[model samples]
Target chain A: MSRQALAELFSRCRAENRAALLPYMTAGLPDPEGSVRLFVAMAEAGADGFEVGIPYADPLMDGPVIQAAGDRALAAGSGVEVALDILEQVVAETGRPSVVMTYVNPVLRMGPEVFAQRLSQAGASGAIIADLPVDEALPFASALDRHGMGLVLFVAPTTTEARLENVVQASPPFVYGVAELGVTGERDMASSHIGSLVARVRKHSEVPVVAGVGIATPDQARSAAAAADGVIVGSALVRRVMEADTVDAAEDALRVAVGELADAIRRD
Target chain B: MRLDRPDNQGRFAEYGGQFAPETLMPALEELETEFAKAWDDPGFHNELNKLLADFVGRPTPVYRAERLSDQLGIDLYLKREDLAHTGAHKINNTMGQALLTKRMGKNRVIAETGAGQHGVATATACALLGQECVVYMGEKDIERQALNVQRMRMLGTEVRPVTSGAGTLKDAVSAAMRDWVATVDTTHYIIGSVVGPHPFPWMVRELQKVIGEELQEQMDGSQRPHPDVIVACVGGGSNAMGIFYPYVGSDVRLVGVEAAGYGLETGEHGASLVAGSPGVIHGSMTYLLQDVQGQILEAHSISAGLDYPGVGPEHAYFKDRQLVEYTSITDEEAVEAVNLLASVEGIIPALETAHALAWIAKEADSLRGQTVALNLSGRGDKDVQQIIDLVDADE
Candidate 1:
């Protein structure tokens, strides 16, 4: 999808009074087929967007749930290429918007230009390279722009205003505001300074700002949606998949969580 | 003068090369120019020498190991690097680099530590210079060397325990490198040894040459023209290179001993030179103990200082060029050497440096009438309690 397409999608989510349900799933967790089916199922179950995680040996900013999923995916011999292929199949099946979530090394290894081109060809809407800072985002951003793909940047609570402005200016689509200092997990969102963070980011950028990182419960998602244009829940969806008794159970649980979160955010 | 030669490709004897990310190319180039100019400036050398003597307590004695030499049937002269302040030859490089950081107008220093010797040395320099210091140590190392961690903290250094990937020295170095790349504007990564991309190995060597320089001066003054052999342990090979570089042109045969935790054949060892193949690791071309698929393997050694999977690039170059003969000493042998030195010489050498002394003891009979000088790299006070525990366990 083009940057314009992603922007329109974000605007539509805002207009419809619904928080964006961005479900995250490791590429080959459970198995490759199960991962693809889960992706399609989540999309069909009303996920506005999906974050397809590429397994790596070291996931610095990930908690135990995501880390274990990544470990299982890696043990199944899944890598960036595998993740992209699975994403291609999911998009082909459901025509849902998706973002590739990965670290910088794999992208660097794949060559930024080629990676962007492949993602664009495979119908991936955008990407969020977790480790790439705003100061070093130009090359990757330019590559994504070259392929008509969006580069989503993360704005943490600790991020300085100057850095946030730089990230907003460099990145396309929208800025993802990390609501807390810790990694992704089903964290207690009551203490998250989500409102002020979204307000600060809104003051600096004309681009849409979505808040993530600990929006676990439907109540938390609704609360986050009240202050931001979008609420991206990842760790909760990943946790559901991990705790599922079977692949079908995982898909069913993810659909139920997304439907409930989407309904809760839309209600108000 | 062929002053531009070493800078041609960031090399020291065709081993050290700038195998770093393109982002660091500019910084490496800048460091190379500054270090080159600093090396020729007599003022810089004089100031460094003064600090080494007054502050760091240099010209650390050359004691004759009379009892051990008599027992082994050879004359052993110990170049006492252990007497240096902060307890290891690591300080020689840190102090020089810290001063260079000041000269370059940088106020923050970052360093990576394995056994925390370098952390202590860097912390000492930062405290002395009043510069803000940050040290990255693996969580495992922080636990193993808690006292050294506390020592670093006492010296006012911020010690960050890295919990990434195996959480060892290699990962710590990786984290430090990442930090340097991100914060290169005000930070000078005082790489703890003769490693890293470029200019670092050469710069560290230039600083550590004091070891060999003093040994030469002291040896000449004592009527011993030169040693028949010079021995030192190799971890990242800083101490060994520090004592061997000045004697390169001389006929003194250099012997580098590595940690053979169990034995070389058991594959449970840190004898990188003997068991490793030349591969690119941590930015420089070096001998690394990697598996069949090129994954860097975890090293095992009783001596924390000697427990690295890769040796310095300079040591790789030396080994390949046949300038130094590499050997291994078992943990059992090193422990015995520590006990022997404490009993005979009344000096306890660091577990790391004891590897060299152990090798010398084992090979002393072959060099019967020859005078061999060993780099007593650090005091064993840090390892005393650990040794006591090991002894008690053995009993």
Candidate 2:
């Protein structure tokens, strides 16, 4: 259901002549109920899709802000099951395709087939395993295929030509192009070189190319969406949600913030 | 006996794959290619052997521990890795990797440290080769191994302290890996174990295999026939791999002793092989001390070196194949073994090595007719301060 829902989403956005605006959230962060509230507001504010994060003990690719959020989520006892639950709630309420962003260990522990089955049952459109390298993504990729779900793979500026081709070929639903060379953090703008990377990805992939990691502002999202099919905003909205004092405050801040980002993404 | 492993994908049985981010995959592939080429080149081996003999004082003497043997009613031989320069077998891997770094045209090196032995050794290698070195050590380890921290800095290497995840060896490894991911083009990550992704586990083992090679030749020359048993302590299991590689298919029995901390039954131990389930940590799938939810549990041990939650993937393979007997020793038992070795043989072993000594002591009476070989992996000078505190408290 989510596989076709995700494809329909991209096509619908394409027909509307605007790029999709995807927002990311670390599940159970700040507080469980607060995270749910924030996600609901993001959906209402015009997020085209969602990428719900599952916290791990060690998140090597995340910067200080996201790492702190993950710490908070883990402290709240929001294990993998809770993250899945949050994804289900987000998809149910919003009726938009959602993906779970997680590291590979948790997926490996749950057994790929079981994890895939549960995520598909929960209505997740796809998953982005931040650390599952191309060489090791095969078994999990196959499992996701059986459940008719997507496995979003990453391509960086430093990714070699041969490896980039492999990533483009293997990835489904969309290709997540890292906007900069560093780990995920809130930067003033995306890397200027992302246009060339998106072009390189475009040569091999017909699926939408979604740029992420370091896209922080409306201007950055606008510029990023100009070169790619869409933009996935993570740290920017997450940072706002993190700074808000309460659930209501977080939802309010996220509502206004997501509206700006969504409007900006539609410009190109 | 000849040893072969890591079938093309760098896996030892079901363990050991490159489970890294996409950005790091190319670098790992590059390393794998370089290592394979270098290992085949005679020139590389020539340079490495030269350093091992002249600089590291390789072919370290194997001495008969007659006094301890008499006390235990067994014939015991100790491979004197304690006499190696920088005071442990760690230099062997560092030296080899430093040479590889130069060959790869990488002028900068980064490493993760636990007990600080690998750090001191890596710093020494970089200083010798004129390569810029950075070592990440757990904050708690930097506190416990103060002398080694000073030694690393004094050798002109930058020591970065890691404050994540129980502040121990596992955290240090995670930090080093993150650094490598961002700086992969100019830096060679000198992983200080036989437990990391691909090429590293195989590379470190091949470099450290000199220990088992020399042991084989030395034992052949000695009056005592082939030893019935061999033992070494395992943290990331480098030294054990070093001594066990050359004897893979032989008749000799091999044992790896892990730090049990308080006790394995109490669940405050680093004996992953004995008490852990299979899980991935630090890029390789291996036996890990993880909870039911797959969250890696912090390990505990008096020995900073062996206080880790994971073991080398090859060791896991060995354990499954029944090729190696994996066991554990508690902190109290290891400390007692340290005192016994000092009093009987006048050689103070590092707390890590004392774990193996404790195992030997326990099984000595049963193997009275057979000869046992143990790798005294390091000298206890670096550990003297910590041991002194423990002893004084006991008094």
Candidate 3:
């Protein structure tokens, strides 16, 4: 998928008075079929986009909830190929855009060219290489672009203005603004200076900016959406899925959370 | 006689192999080639020897422990590596690898440190070589060894505190390895000990052989050409191997001592050589203290130097060949030896080295008529304040 396609999806979410959105969940978490069902359910519940996490042995940026989910996925013998297969099933069921979120090791292990080809063939909308800095991303970025897949770049709160500009220049899709200095989690969002951060990133790029990392409640989602074009909620949604007594309970909790967030963003 | 028997596939007696990710295969292969060439290069040896003598303050003293020996009724000698620059034997290996990294054209040095000794050593070399240095340390270690953290910062090295996986040495190593894999082009990971994948154990052991080599020359000049027994503490076993390698075929009995923590039978210990079973961890098949399901268990020791779950593959080889006898010393014994040596010999020993001292004290009666050489691997200067504080706390 092209940058234009992602922008179009964001536009539709905004036109519908909803948050231009993405929800992240580790693939094969709990179980393969259940995780796939949740992904399809989230898309059906009006999630504009999805980030399918390829579980890793060391997910350095993840919080306890996501880490536990990833551990469950890995223990179940889930890998990048398994994650892609699940994504394929979700895409076939929901027909919504999905991106593969992973650290650079698995991609490097699979070979960049092969990874790009496999992602494109699996119908993934884009790829987010979390640990690949712009200085070291040329090879992977070029391969993704060659395979007609968008390479989403993460701009952290600690990133300098010069580095932010470099990231904007290197990014193929929307710039993902990490909401904090640390990993993903359900943190108190009262002190987040996301509005100023979004403004700074907006000055550097023409692309949409999506705020993520520690966004949990509908209030935080609305606050993030007020500043940026999109709000990405990961750890909170992952926690709900993991803590739910059953798959149906998980889907219900996710639908209610997404609905509340959608309404909060749509409010004038 | 060669102790390292690389199989046809280049394994070290079922212990060593290239277990790194495929992304590092080419680089590892390149390192293997460069190392083979450098091992044979007279110029490389000359440079390393010069650096060892000038930079590292090598030929570290072979001081006879008069007071301690007199008390135990035995002749005792100490290999004073504590006097080496940077306060330990760790710098010897770091300087060698940093020089090799420079020769390989790598512009940066990255390493994982346990007790911060290795971090300081690597940072010192990086500062001298004008290479960018980043040291990964566990968060827990940074808090415990705050002085070393400041030392690294003062040396202009970036010290990254890894907060993952219980925040200890093992996690620090995992993080460093991941960083090395990602930044292979511009980075060289200087492994702190004789652990990790192939080439590290071989490289570190070769660099550290100076301890044994110097001991040989020093003994030759003295009345006794060789001691009846050689004792050294084994963490990852570099220091022990350094003092033991040259005497492998000799009549000198080699003894490796490991930390017993509370006690070896309590399952709360770092005695990999004594209480551990054979297993694979961090790319080497060595004796590891692992759980029933094969997961590596966290090791416990009052001394950070001994807090490792597995030993180096070379030590494993020696143990299997029965060339060396491995044993354990309890925390109480180690502490007693520390105080005993300090009061009797005017030399404070590192807690890790105290394990060897403790073992020597126990076996002193049996070995009374014979001379024994002990590797005082590092001075207790870095550990002195902590030891005093602990003693006072107990009192």
Q: Which candidate wins on TM-score?
A: 2
What DockQ do you compute for every candidate structure? 0.07, 0.69, 0.04
Could you tell me which 10 consecutive residues in candidate 2 chain A have the lowest summed lDDT? Answer: A181-190
- Output DockQ, candidate 2: 0.69
lDDT of each: 0.80, 0.88, 0.80
Better of 2 and 3 by DockQ: 2
Q: Any residue pairs clashing in model 3, and if so which?
A: none
Please give, for residues A8-64, the per-residue lDDT of candidate 1 as tens digits. 777788778765667677888778878898888887777777788888655545666
| Per-candidate chain B TM | 0.96, 0.98, 0.96
Report how far off residue A50 is in candidate 3 (Å).
Answer: 16
Residue A225 of candidate 3: its Cα lDDT? 81
**Mind giving the per-residue lDDT tens digits that candidate 3 earns over B58-160?**
8899888878888898889999998898888999899888988988999999999877889999999999999999999988778767777888999999999
Colliding pairs, model 1: none
Candidate 3 stretches greater than 4 Å from native: A1-268, B1-5
Query: What TM-score between 0 and 1 does chain B of candidate 3 receive?
Result: 0.96
